[model samples]
Target: MNQSLNRIAAMTARYYYILRSSWLRLLEIVYWPAMQMMVWGFLYTYLYQSRSAMADTAGLLLGAVLLWDVLFRGQLGFTFTFLEEIWSRNLANLMMSPLKPAELAASLMLMSLIRLLIGTIPVTLLTLLLFGFNIYALGPGLLVFFLNLVLTGWAIGLVVAGLVIRQGLGAESLAYSIMIVLLPLCCVYYPVEALPLWLHPVAWSLTPTYVFEGMRAMLIHGVFRTDLMIACLALNAVYLGIGFTTFVLLLQSARHKGGLLTMGE
Candidate 1:
């Protein structure tokens, strides 16, 4: 067990070192979030000009875009970090060691957080300068939403990572497609009521739905829903449990079938 832990530490340090050495990696992380903020900032400004009634939603959509990126970065961070092992054809080596799946999952979560912080902080800062909107104004609520978003990302990422292990790179699209499917239902830029009445149940059942709804309530109505925050935390717990369990099972299946040894090829 101690040897496995040591190996995990070495693997983490190697990846961290790679990140530190790669200036392009840093720039790539900064690029997309900044790009999104620019596009959305212009859109928000245009809406404020074109529709007097839309003026009240100045930072609402922009804020959602920023917050949603947290979740996006988190999931991608976790999955891509895991896939790095495969792309380097090192996953089989790790699996051949005493390293356990749970340990690997936990490490991936930590690395995801590191990448998320690195990716989003600059974009958040830039959004403030570009739009004069400070997401930090959400105060402690900002932290709440951030945690839930990352956890939700990890949940999705775990499932993606597991599937890739089971079915190879062909299943890789699940990483982005699954999140895209949830985008409309997440109530990111609009309230859940904007969806059809029939889809309301499905939307509300998602953790991010409460997150965006609560964000809107706070920003627009100055009303913070403790209920929504509580709901997100509760649902995240359940979803994360399911995601982790599925990952472990899928990984075991892959190992038994010897797919891990040949995944990157």
Candidate 2:
């Protein structure tokens, strides 16, 4: 048990050392999320002023944006940390260490949480100050919703990381772009029903779809859809399981093929 903890700790420290050494990386954690919030927050404000149908737009849109970032930042946090090792040529060193795949994943999950907090907290507070919107108003279920989205992001990140591990940097671009493909399917800015009937099943398959739907329901109708929340949680668990298994298999495959050593070259 202690050995596993140490492995996880060592992996976490490796990334922490990198983050501490670079001011730009630290600044980047906060910059992009804040910038995105500012742009969308203003657009949401404009819609509120211009559209009677959007009278209560601030809470709904801001909440959706913030929640969406939970997923985005979570995935970026995990993949970027993994990619950083690749960029610094540290992947080989780490792979050669006593660390196990599960331990490395545990470390990445912790790093993702840290990055998610660093990236989202400032923007969340800014929204409260500038727009007088508190997403927490969605109530206790907010925590569950946030976890569901973050887990979903982690699942996707793990898949991307696995692909990169097995296929090398050729697959690295998926780390940044996977979420974009997932965004529309997630129903972030709109309801699932707004999508074509054919895509409804696809949207529903992605857990965040239910999460955002639940968020809109809470904001617009003062209704908390526990069923959606439950579904999201269950789906997240399944996806997370699949993601972790895939990552471990790919890492092992890479080790067998000497892909880890080649990655640093």
Candidate 3:
């Protein structure tokens, strides 16, 4: 236990030093999310005041955007942790260490949480102070909704990380592009019913769809949908399992193919 904790600490320190040294990186953590909140917050305000059909427009749209970032930042955090090691040419060194793969994963998960907090907290607070919109108004269900989104994000990040492991830097773009591709299917600013009839099933298969749906339900209807939460949790479990397995298998494949050594080159 002590060894695992030490490994996690060491890995944390590794990224901590990188973040500490780069002011631009720190700015990036806060900038994009804040910008997104500001733009969406205004649109939400407009809708709230002008749209008679949509009563809870502010809560619904703001909640969806904030919650969606939890997933986006979470995935980016996880992928960037791995990408950092690769970019710094430290993957080989880490692989040679006594650090186990599970420990590495735990450390990356911790880093993901750190990154998520750094990125989202400011935007959340700004939305509250500036727009008088508090996502926490969703109440205790917000906790469950957050967990579901972060877990799904981590699952997607792991899958992308796995691909990078197997394909080297050639697959690194997945870190940025995968989530965007998934954005439409996630039904972030809209509802699943808004999608084309054929895409409804595809949207439902992704866990974030249910999470955003549940968020809207809580805001608009004042009822927490336990069924959507259940479905989201179940789907997340399956995806997480597949993601972790794929990451491990790809890591081994990289090892055998000498891909790790060339990763930095």
The positional error of residue 170 in candidate 1, measured at the CA in angstroms, is 0.8
List, residue by residue over 1-265, the lDDT tens digit for candidate 1. 7876776687678679878888999888888888988999888878777768788787898889999999899999899899888888888888887778878887888889988999899988887787777999998989999999999999999999999999899988777677888898888988988999999999988999988998999998888889999989999999999999999999989878787888899
lDDT of each: 0.88, 0.87, 0.88
State residue 144's C-alpha deviation in candidate 1, in Å.
Answer: 0.4
Sliding window of 10 residues with minimal summed lDDT for model 1 = 3-12
The order of the candidates by TM-score, greatest first, is 2, 1, 3
Task: Please state the error at residue 44 of candidate 2 in Å.
Answer: 2.2
**TM-score for all predictions?**
0.95, 0.95, 0.94
The CA lDDT at 37 in model 1 is 85
Model 2: per-residue lDDT, tens digit, 1-265?
9999988988888878888998999899999988888898887778777867776666678888899889888998999988988887888888778888888889999999988888887888888787777877777988888899889988998999999999999998898889999888879989888899999999999999999999988888999999999988999999999999999998888878876886945
lDDT of 3 by residue, 38-148 (tens): 998888788778757765566777888899889989999999989998898888898899998888888888899898999988889999998889887888899999899
| Candidate 2: 10-residue stretch with minimal lDDT | 51-60
2 or 3: which has the higher TM-score? Answer: 2
- Cα-based lDDT at residue 149, candidate 2: 86
- The total of clashing pairs for model 3 equals 0
- Evaluated against the true structure, the overall lDDT of model 3 is 0.88
Candidate 2 runs further than 4 Å off: none
